[model samples]
Target: MSQEITAAQRQHPTRVASKPSSYRPEVQGLRALAVLMVVTYHIWFGRVSGGVDIFLLISAFLLTLSFIRKVEAGRPLALGRYWMHLFKRLLPAVVVVLLAVLAATALFVPRSRWSDILAQTWSSLLYFQNWVLAANSVDYYATDQSVASPLQHFWSLSVQGQVFILWPLLFALAAVIARATRVRFRRIVLLVFGVVFVLSLTFSIHETYTNQAHAYFDTRTRLWEFAFGTLLALAIPYLKLPRPLRIAAGWVGLAAMLSGGFILDVQGQFPGYVALWPLVAAALVIVAGQTGSPIGADRVLTWKPLIRLGDMSYALYLWHWPILVIYLIWRGREEVGLVGGSAIIALSLVLAYLTTKFVERPLRSMAWVDAKKRRSGVVIAVCVALVAVPVAGWQQGLQVQKERAEAEAVQNNPGARVLLDGYEDQSSPESPTLPLLSSLGSEWGTLDGDCSSYDDGPTDPVLAERCVGTDSQDYEKTLLVLGDSHSQQWLGAIQPMAESNEYRVFALMLGACPFGEPNSERRPECNDFNEAALRYAHELKPDAVVAVGTAAHPTEAQDNVVAGLPEAAVDLAGFGIPVVAIRDNPRFGVNMIQCAEANGDRGDDCAFPLSDKLSDSSEMAAIFDSLQGLALVDMTDLICPDGWCSPVVGNVFVYLDDNHLTKSFTASMSGEFDRRFHDAVHW
Candidate 1:
């Protein structure tokens, strides 16, 4: 929104106006340098852009200095005036970018991805993009750059806006307190700065240890960096430095700031001591500027090219990230190597410069820049509303379309449909035997797990107590399939086989349950769900108990279920009752649905091989070997052969997530699974 400004002689009751021409070209050069570091780091280095830290210091110095000078001059501080200036400076170009991005996304990205883009666009417009991205917890160091969101660049702006909203109030309050109590303004301000600094520092460390992702985005954790700048601001004017000392500080600061760009890497735990280096460097440069030293800001930062970049820095920062992200996504790699990444950076810079020249500068110099007669707020509101309304509608429409498409595709491709919904009913005793005629529409009715409500037992369409027809059978041979979704996913295949083989399969699975002891409050759910599963297995007196999951170990039980199971199920020598483990299929981390849509394949042709899906790591191999008193079935060969696994094999979709095979794929592999089970367990 734009703020109303007038040529009237009015000023705020608590502020004084500084000279209007206090524009510092050197600061612009600093901004240019900061943006360059951020863009380069994000695209090629996978590290914090020391540039952002530098920018934060600049912001703190400029804004704090402005506020303090006005307050000290016996003039009123108009919060409205400050907001107006900020709004005019920030809004027009941001709104333009949002509109352009919204248009580009609609035209280029798949319908399935539109929802994410829309949400991000809205957040970007609101300057809340950082929080939105933080909530998603995207890993910056991850090699998969294709999944990077377009609006991820807005996090810095979000942090800045958040700090801006608070810094002024703190300054005003500290000033008022000093005046009221006859305390020196500097002392009062410094005390407030110290308190904020301490609180922010303490919280940042705690958050970094507890949740680094949260620490990165949370305003509380970041407030200290800005406060550090604020502290430097209060001390600057009081210092009257000698010429040589000022020159040395300037050059040293410049070297420290520039050198920091090369020294810092992504591995550094950020916002800790590492950030202070750049912040201090920026502050030193600013302080040196006032003295006009030969080795200071004027000699280096005011160079033509640096000034040019600095003039466009704000626009560049906004534009560069999205360009790089979209380019990386287009390339469809987890990590773009440095060469390609550098090319992306070059392109982003070109666009940034063009955007700054055409969009930001013109708007700032317009005759209406400070006009109060016309309602600029109304114009901004309209502009924002136009961008927001379409994006929201597009997002909602895309969601509906995706759901419809997913439903249709699932219906048409019975395998994916079955896996999506069949787990619920198939695991129950009454409905354990899925009708052979049932297709993808055969709904599972909802399953429960200790960690998830999936196994809480059917309350809806309330599954009959004996769905598996277990009461009619002589419950002599019992098999338990317990673990996470990886284990539960097998119900469609295993249940059918168990029913035909005259064996009952008892399940004690939990979603995301690693079979470990209680960790969170959710532990109760795990305990209760496992207890129910174990009770049923024990009562059935099965000949064999199968613990099936991609990642379940014998000692990792929630309450030592392995020791509690009837001794008949456990034989020191391969256990009397053999456990059967089904190796999970490959999982695609990228949203295959969106990829399919983008490729215009109608969601059928886009799939990768199992071997190509994930790295061959010890963690995966270990998950396959953790079952005790059981025979593990290595199905990696069933789905993958010659070191390749296709998403669609024999007209079957192999997986829904990173692991669970689609029911269609499961059905296709049923014959293979049956053979593996028979060979391993002698069933």
Candidate 2:
């Protein structure tokens, strides 16, 4: 989009053939507008702007025009040379940003975010950031695990990378067909893209509705936008808008792009039918064809200020998100207001200009690397290697830090003391050690990689090794624990009970899924997984089914909390299995370990009101009371103890992240858990 790039992505001779496509300042202006929309939405609204969708279209539209022209001209397509040029041009600026993020992460962001940042960095470099993000998008909890990483914005860039690589192949195939079949090259290419646009758009609409959180980052789902652009490109050579219509369309399109964020619920509705708002708008502006009328939006879009900004748009887009994120982390704000957003925008602009001028332009235009295909390829390889080596070192450093933290993990483990010695006064340090305490959420009771966690789900995989029994061959009563990660977190506490009593532990846990009503949450495969678990339970008919019975939907801390019981328990009771339901824990909605690191041991500073964390989820208990064999186990007191639930209690941290309990802390509650189990179920 930034023509400062000499990637030769668009063919040289083709640009002449594809006149009017030669220099579309209006398109560049659209690019500028898109970047601004993204930055503004991210900063003030914490929502996706749909502006990125516009860029995706424009990028594909231009590339398709040039490639089709080349294919029609009976050229070699210069696949090797074109790819080599892109490698040299696109990656240098990206690498600089990756390096900058790494540095900023170490300096400003908490150690909690380091690993995720590193993962995103590598993912971005490999151009599969969207997949990585999609994998992590839906987890055991109701909310995202961490603050949006500095590199998360790179997902769109990854999609662009896919387009850049794959779009040419489509054209190359079209070229082959055109030569062999005596069909018009343009018509063949158009036919192929039209087919792709329909198929991809259909799949996208389905995926977005069924699994929207992930659909936002799914490359498969995004292909429609890119393919749609190709279709437009194929049509553009024939498009000739009248001056009056062009003038009207240019204004209409600009108005839509500018007003999209304000008028739409992008987060809930985007990456689906709603995405057409921006994509279609950009398409109209592009097809409107730089009208020379005073009323034309191009007259505004081609303004010098916009053209210059558009030149920096790529760099600006790359730099703005991280800058905004780091700035918010530095200021300790969950969301920013006008002034913070302005400051972030100011700094981002300054950095964007600097990076474009110094890093992107100079590196993208390097004459030495541009001379030969082999040389350019070597430069690209070297640049990637440079980033990878340090990232590898940094990831290893985090591993070493985790080992040290685990070495100290034993001291933090107060076996059985939570119930016996209970609530020992302890002062939390100003901050927990970096990487270790910050990384504890990942360090839960190891299922030895066999047990499926959030990563394996919303696709459920059944495993048995992590399922412990007094003796698998001989157990009087089989205990099946069911639910998601919150359900899995209690494994340590429940394992002790399994050992003491003669019961085999069968964990039918799916991350973020608890068998309940209608599968309204609609996490992917959740309903299927829950149904399968119910069938598995009926087949096994475990002596007792234990589950974390309440759903704590994410909300503000001050909101009246309502923890509803999943209907799985009632169904289990119907199956004649006495159900043990543990009350869900308090949710702080921020990473507890990270909060402790920042705020120290001040319970008041770190803790929210117990009332805010728990409501009369007791209604669930009453519902179960009517069921013949269902028992409600309320341990809210164990978690929140006082009126305020402390993040760290009795020298052990409580919540692992926002809601789930620490494995060590849960283990420490063995006696209380045991006592409560006997009182509630009387097994």
**Please, what is the TM-score per model?**
0.68, 0.84
Worst 10 residues of 1 by lDDT: 1-10
lDDT of 1 at 623: 43
lDDT of 2 at 159: 92
How many clashes does each candidate structure show, in the order listed?
A: 34, 1
Compared with the true structure, all predictions reach lDDT values of 0.59, 0.74
What C-alpha RMSD separates each model from the true structure? Answer: 10.2, 5.9
In the range 294-356, model 2's lDDT, one tens digit per residue, is 878898899999999999999899988989888878888789888888988998899889988
lDDT of 1 by residue, 577-682 (tens): 4556554455555544344334533233554444454435345446435545546566665555445544443233454433454454555455556777788777
The whole-model C-alpha lDDT of candidate 2 against the native structure comes to 0.74
Off by over 4 Å in 1: 1-21, 107-112, 138-146, 290-297, 332-350, 365-374, 406-411, 416-513, 516-548, 551-582, 587-645, 648-683
